[model samples]
Target: MQILANIIPYFISQVENFSRRERISFAYLSIENVLGFSKSDCILKNDFKINKKDIKSLINIVNQLKKNVPIQYIFEETIFYNLKFKLNKSTLIPRNETEELVKWVLQYKFNSLFDIGTGSGCIPISIAKNSNSIISALDISLDALEIAKINAMYHNVKVDFICDDIFSYIPKRKYDIIISNPPYVLKSEKVFMSKHVLDHEPHSALFVDDSNPIIFYERIIKLSSDYLNDNGMLFFEINEKYSGDIIKILSKYNFVDIELKKDINDRDRMIKAVMK
Candidate 1:
């Protein structure tokens, strides 16, 4: 008879190279995925014996974790605004700061909405689930748009997903609200990010030239005048360092009621401007 190996010790050893938080997360995900157990079940059965057949697969997952592959991509999904979004190497994983931006918009009502750089369709899909709004989402990468479309369909939200470069693209119909979380990270700022992001995530989705950190902002703001209805609103998730610069650009475009808001970390992360 084969001896059943105890789960806890092996799980700990496999995730030893990870951080404390990562260790916990990897263990939780592994046990849940392998055993079809919930987080609560993971704890309750921490000592549960595992089938030796599963050990090799768990080791592979742990090795990937050791290499700093983001669990979201490895799992091929992530939760955004309490909704599931399928992930891919081509799209940026939606962040909590974005969820805060979504929450801020949910406080106001709008009939038509447009999302710029809709990587995973997280922004528009989340809003569509809660609000009955006509939403349009655009991405520069067709590969990213494919993943976004999958997410939109999975959520059963009707969004007009477009694949085009926003720098040259123009909208035919004006929208009541425009929102974007464009590529704000500067090339010089790559040192500040983790290996998982810098190595695995799409650079086109994460970075812009340092000389023009807000290049996308400039293009989108200039294009906004043509696509925003009277009294329309524009919202942005900005790099904290460029918050003031973004506000000035919006003001230069004659947008009024400009406000800069911070995320939970107290970093300036959001800005809102209204058409006069």
Candidate 2:
């Protein structure tokens, strides 16, 4: 147990590629999960003794980290838009860009909303927390939908979760807004991604064949005209390299008021359009 005190420095040294802030954040998060301690505990009691069982668990996590597994997946949970969600290999972990998309949707006038590819249900649940609109979330992976359902329960929000591919699922009712953070990464780009993401995350939730990077967008836009009310909005978290291509697709569909947004990192990460 006393050995755990040495683990921090060791972890920081091993994670040299990470910024100091990232190291501290990951260390604190991993420790909290294993030791049930808070950030203050870590700060005020740097030499606090860890139990043997906790040490073993922490060591396992460290080994996983060494293999470039994402820390969020190591812990199996993460906070998105101030809400906690359970995550696993079955779904893509929620990202800040998705949170921004949710914020954009919450600001719009919508009587009912649908989240396409709502892995882990973070986006729709966060929106439901702030707005009174009826929400439904759809995902093709049943395993992902199970995690989403658990997240909805954990957040105490009522959302209709459908386990079906967004491209095939036709909504019986019209929605004023539809949001999605679809799989848009090109397979050719996978070689350039961080090992932490490419190795640990599910491929189905991340990649599209380079030959058809906009496949999901084309299908969604085609079906959206039927499900979206006149003047309804469509929001997407898009691949930055293909933003111009996405705009062309929306234009082809006759969607108006098209806009592209940047994330905090200044990457073109989101797009919005209105059904004309």
Candidate 3:
């Protein structure tokens, strides 16, 4: 049997290539994942005994962390907007900025909504759990849509999961809101990203061509004209570097009431506009 207190230090020592803060955070999360122990429980129950099997699991988690695999993927699940969702390499892990975009989406009421490039169905499922909107989500990858469908079922939320590339998709009906946290990272921006993200997360869900970094945004904006109801709202989780360019695209498409909002990090990471 291993005491919780002793395990933490050992876990920390085994994990590398991360900052001091990250090591501590991962250690706590590893404990929680392996033992169902909270952060406070680690200290309060420092004498908590871990059996051999759990100890092995914790060690495996630490080894994965050392290799820069995200903790969420290790656990195969993550909590977003207070809802638990399954995850895998098939989907990009939901981001805080995307949560902010969902918050902006939840601020208004709409009947029918559609999400473009829904990876794990985090956005629409969270909104569906909170609102009565009829939500439909689209993704090109069947693997991603499979995970998304499972998440919707687990959450007991109804979302029409469509497996289709957004560029070729023709909306069968208009929606009161169309939202997306689509691929906005340019291929050139790969150097600035973390090793864990570049190495683990799905590339097609993350990157756009440097030649047309705003391709997803532009296609969604153009489609919004046909897919959105009169005066319908449109929302996007944007790349901070190209917020101005996205606004210009929206304007060129004749969208009005364009609003750009920052994430918790104060980066220009979200944009909302109205269909005129």
lDDT values, one for every candidate: 0.86, 0.86, 0.90
**C-alpha TM-scores of all predictions:** 0.94, 0.94, 0.96
lDDT of 2 by residue, 1-276 (tens): 374466677678777757777777788787778777787877777788777887788778777877888888988989999888899999788888888888878777788998888888888889988998889999999999999999889888999999887766788798999888889988888788998888888899999888899999888887887789999999999989889988998999899999999999999999999997
The number of the candidate with the highest TM-score is 3
Order of models, best lDDT first: 3, 1, 2
Clashing pairs in model 3, backbone N/Cα/C closer than 3 A: none
Q: Candidate 3: worst 10 consecutive residues by lDDT?
A: 7-16
**Candidate 1 ranges beyond 4 A from true positions:** 1-8
Worst 10 residues of 2 by lDDT: 1-10
Model 1: how far residue 192 lies from native, Å: 2.6
RMSD of each: 2.1, 1.7, 1.3
| Ordered list by TM-score, greatest first | 3, 1, 2
